[model samples]
Target: MQHLEDRFNKRFGYPWVFLNEEEFDESFKTAVKGQTSAPVSFGLIPRDHWFQPEWIDEERATQGRMEMKAANIIYADNVPYRNMCRFNSGFFFKHPLLQPYRYYWRVEPDIQYFCDVTDDPFDYLRDNKKTYGFTISFYEWEKTIPTLWATVKEFMNLHPEYIAAENAMNYLSDNGGETYNLCHFWSNFEIADMDFWRGEAYTKFFEFLDSKGGFYYERWGDAPVHSIAAALFIPKDELHFFRDIGYRHEPFQHCPRGEDWMRGRCSCNSYDTLDYAPQSCISRYEKMFH
Candidate 1:
């Protein structure tokens, strides 16, 4: 991450970083790390465990929570980490310090990039009311996500108080509790409005989900967790498409300039980019050879 930041700064000039202690590794701190680049500061959210360890979740949740609580100490002391994880990384606060910054671009280390970004994405968000933005999209992991749906349903059931809320409850539910079509997003790289996150709806939503303990048991990835929550909590119109920055999404490739992003790419041929439109889901899902 440090090497990437150094190179990123040299290229982009003090890019903003939402980072954590884990990124504080020797390689990371060496370059124009956090403070080196003015507003390019790091959020430094606390991370309990990397979620890479021994023992099944059922046996280790208690230990995990303890570690997470210890990490939260930094926030309690008024210190904050730019990087945040939903589970043990307890930095899901009310967006206190983020007000000054008009935009937030999520940063994760070690990902592939194929094309250069010609347009300025941050300016796009700042100029327009694009409260939510992402590059890739996919369905939920049914096994791991069943609990998430259940948790969301239970939250709505118990808080019938928020049934009338304008932001979240609506987007998360169209056919009652059957689906979450609006929950699709590529959170590995999210650049959004901080004001939208600091709202009461999102604030309480995170807290409600946080209390559920699934972040420990089900092993929720912050990317998907945040995606679902943001989908539920943020308005759809504020969402946007950056059809130019090239990004690698695990098994898929994203290219804004590729003829695909210009229209839609779902070709099995990895040689060509995949499609973003759902109409291509059929032929594209048939084979994985590409």
Candidate 2:
């Protein structure tokens, strides 16, 4: 919170809205409030929005967890993590406190902002007519989402009207939506227009994915879920790659290159940027432009 406030929010004065499954403690509220002069709001996620739906079979879900655990996938046995993924994928934009806002920059704890943000990102997104903005892109774990692509293809066949004419399908699949290549814009750092998600195409997409029970059965993450939807339902131009933002979340970091690095007085080493890594999908995302 302080990193964002010091680097960006202090300049734009955008309000911060934090949501959790339970009420935040007084100290937590005080600490966050002390970080910025901008308005701060805390929202408790509704029970239905944050838990495994009753229709999901616990036995089948447990078996799925066991299979993933045997394969040694990270967070394979963690139920809350799956719940959080589902919530972020479908419900975060619907929270009452967030309703008044059209644009949102989603921030997670322990993320580092290495540069000073001089421009208003929300205004930039609004003015440019961008729907979703992201700093990082990468491949997801195939072990976690075995059936997701098939399910998505099924959704596409059932509702062809929702698919955009000039979409980012190539970024998602090499064989024309026959399979997923696993590339996704890492969603932990997102600057986007919530109205896009609230729109009919995404609403139906999320509902279809949720009805499949993949969140509980196979750990379908919000990163890929949001990325796929944005790639399929909107023009590729609507997805903005925030290459200028210097940011880091643990193992992966996006360090602005050349002029942006010097201009922002960014603290991260440009040579260490994740865009250079073999696992990075940034090259594929960039291919859309050329």
Candidate 3:
């Protein structure tokens, strides 16, 4: 994170805030320059290791469980080395940034932040009623998603009272059950709604996924988890795709194309904005801005 931030600073001056999960505050504090507020070093990464240090034992255990699974896929297997992020996308709702306002921007470690972000992503979320948004979405191997659906099924059965739609299931399960298009919105970079995600249904979904060890064995990542949650839990029209991200994820990438007002990139699907326009929410924002 420090190294990536160092590179980012050469070209960008955006406020860089490091939320601590625990410890490392002194080291984290020393490494960062300019005005910054430190939050819980990114929140507890639920781990399962028994002999682990107790400095923040509970979090580590939880991380071992939830954080490791999703992170294991590309992180340990691919180049970036080391384990996948423990805090992962949990930092978004953790709300160190939104306590005063109502939204937040989330950046992952080691990702490149390019292009001038003149537009406010939070307002974009509000104008569209979008609970979640992402710059990229792509396919993941079928093998890795072994237990995620099973767990979700369990959650559905247990919470029979919760309302879910047939289309939402289509958004999640696809036409068949053998594979997940895995078109999860890349969470490495995001700006999103707080209330939409912190609600009972979304929280229950995470807990349900956690209980079934989806975050562990199947490597169910925040991308897929958030995608499924947003697709199944949140209304369809309210979910959005930010065409301006020009996002790149090594193995896969999405660049902005003819999204009119967006003039942004969207690799989630070749056809995503084909029906809509990049200006999508931007066009409406103009009316509101009017």
The best candidate in terms of lDDT: 2
Clashes of each: 13, 0, 32
Worst 10 residues of 1 by lDDT: 74-83
lDDT of 1 by residue, 175-235 (tens): 6557554344667777777666666655676677766655554445565566655655555
CA lDDT for candidate 3:
0.50
Q: lDDT tens digits, residues 1-290, model 3?
A: 44333323333434544443343456555655423332323323334221122343454345544544565544423211112422342334544444544665676555553333456666678876767676665554445566666666666668755644432444444454344545455667666776756678877766566545444333456766776677666556665666665544454444455552244222244443322343222332222223
TM-score versus the correct structure, for each prediction? 0.65, 0.99, 0.64
RMSD over all Cα atoms, model 3: 8.5
Candidate 2 Cα misplacement greater than 4 A, ranges: none
Error of 3 at 266 (Å): 14
Using TM-score as the yardstick, the better of models 1 and 3 is 1
- Candidates ranked, most accurate by lDDT first: 2, 1, 3
The C-alpha local distance difference test score for the whole of candidate 2 amounts to 0.93
